[model samples]
Target: MFFDLALVFLCIAAVSQFLYFLLITSNHKDFVKRYNRDFKEFRPKVLLTVPCKGLDMGFFRNILSLMRLDYENYNIHFVVESESDPAYESLQRIIDRCRDDMPAGFAKVLVAGISKGYSQKNHNLLHSLRFAPHDTEIYAFADSDTRVSRLWLAHLMYPLRNSKYGVSTGYRYFIPARRRFSNLALSSMNAAAAQIMGKSKYTTQVWGGSMAIRKELFEQLNVANLWQKSISDDLTLSAAVRNAGYKIRLMPRCFTVTFEDMSWGQLFEFGRRQMLITRVAYLRMWLWGLFCLLNHFLGVWILPVAAAVRFAMGENDAKLFAAAAVIHWASLIYRTYMRRRTFEFVLGPYGGYVRQLSMWEFLLNPLWLALMLALILISSFGRTICWRGVRYRLNGAFDIERLNR
Candidate 1:
């Protein structure tokens, strides 16, 4: 009886994974169709905001790449919290070296005063918004650690030409750090998550690292009020745009690179924080989060155990486990084929490790999930999270405390 139940559960899990795979493929095709549409002739002035807190591994290369954008009319605004920040020094060095080489009106840096918000990035952005060119029609926000392709600005701006789209968010590709086990785990997890989320119709949250929107729409949305209490401003902004009857399109043709080399502890903390915010921002999609936990565990650990159990039971039933293994390999191959040469090389091998590591991580997942839920509950009870050397509290309505930080 127990064996029968296990078989049933295995079949259900396999079917759910298959369904998720179909959803992603369909969404990718839909995105491709929209991307092929012709862009309008309007060339709006752009303000690219880079909110810098500290130095990151690819900071210089990322900043330099932005200055080299293919767009004809755009300005890069580097925002820092204080003049004493080490990032300020790095920005100054890059400006001194690259400003002369960039296109006209393409480079500028500003020091911003702290504002009342749980998000330091948003606080820095609000101050820099004051310096935004009055004629600017598009506002682009990216993290300090993100690297962009040459055509990034062109693709980001293309969606804004349509009046229906209030904001456009792009995808993120991970740059693996050496051959470390934790790095591999982090990279593969991100890639798989992106594949699943990018392919969903109801998934509207924008990645904070690479997002673009119209300046007018942003003003209309009253972004300050919209994201005042939000820890994850990107998701909040996307939700706000959708609620305001404006479309938030996820473009397929463009993507940005985020440099993340998190230690095991840091990765856990970051993932926990993300899970907490996701619960609030995408309540409906929270089930998908649970699905992710289950999928990763089953694909990596549970299947192997089930297969072993079947093997001990009888050789004839071993086919059941073999079939499941084939499905797992096929899915990984498909993902590799789809991702192409981008990060698949790393993910292909790393995915195997993810499966092995899950045996251990799965044991702690229940506790971790409980902890994340508790954090969310506590956060809802009060609004504040200490982040990046600052403390911010939120009001009952999720608005930021107006007091100066």
Candidate 2:
């Protein structure tokens, strides 16, 4: 009786996940339609701030993509914690080489010095804001490792023209620099997170890698003061926006691409750091994610084990459990394929790369989920996280203790 009951619950969860996947698919289709609408005349004086630490994969190409944005009336402020950081020198070289070919605005590197209490990325961003021109209307943030399309700025800022939206966010999609197991595994895991993002309020969160907020809303919410000691800019800002009774619009066209090649250790560290941050700052979201992880874990791992045991016992309903396992795995792979299609619609230039990634995801999603479950379980017990070689203890969402600068 217990076995039968468990199987019933598993089937319900599987159907629910599939329905949720369908909902996100519909939301993505709406997002694609929004991408076709023109926003050429809605240019706002924007400040694009990217905080850098080390030299990421394809760092030069990523920075160059920022310099080549097709928008007008915007400036790129690349900030590093110190001049000693490798990215600082690279930023200088890129600006020097691409000055004549840049768009309407200028690109310059700023040194934010060392962080005292907050994460270095937040410190760099807040420091650069101090130097932003008084006339700047919108503040945009991107990560150093991401390569964006020329229309990234245009699409990210366009939604803010409506007063109801508090912030606009774009997520990152990973492309493996090499087709190795670890590289493909990390990309597949990252894609699983990215696939959940869409136009719905419940599903949208501020992604600092590609997000924009108007200056008026920024000051009204006192985001600068809010971010003073927070470890995560994107998650904290997401909370602030929602608390202030504002909506975050997910912009599909602004999805940034990241080319990555990670070893197994690096992959584990990256995954753990992200889960730890979410666990510390966003408990409810973390709990929901944990619930989803466990559901997927059980469906893929536990269900198969139960099926094998029943089969060995020569049970009559063994085929039912076996069929459920196949359905769950199929749902995961089908959803991944659907998500890749949505990405290819906007990031058209990387169509081949996204296609290749989908193949890896189909093959490795079960293993990826298992690794993700392990990362989530491990992260549940830690408050300290290391990001970009800096270790800090998270006291709460806003309180932080930096162990090293």
Give all candidates' CA lDDT scores.
0.66, 0.85
Predicted candidate 1, C-alpha RMSD: 5.9
Candidate 1 whole-model C-alpha lDDT, 0 to 1: 0.66
Error of 2 at 327 (Å): 3.3
The segments of candidate 2 whose C-alpha lies over 4 angstroms from its true place after superposition are 1-7, 311-323
- Residue 390 in candidate 2 has what lDDT? 92
Across 297-334, the per-residue lDDT of candidate 2 in tens digits comes to 88888778878988999987778778878877777767
Query: What TM-score would every model get versus the actual structure?
Result: 0.78, 0.94
For residues 1-405, could you state the per-residue lDDT of candidate 1 as single tens digits? Answer: 796777757756864675577557555645555564434465679888889988888888888888887777888889988888889988988988987778637676788766654566776777777888788888888877777766677777877888998888776766655555555555555655565544454655688777888988898989976665665678788778888988876665456666667786666555555655566556656566665555645654566677788788785666676677667656655554454432332233334444443443334433443444443344334344455666544443354444335
In model 1, how many backbone clashes occur? 0
* Residue 219 alpha-carbon offset, candidate 2, angstroms: 0.9
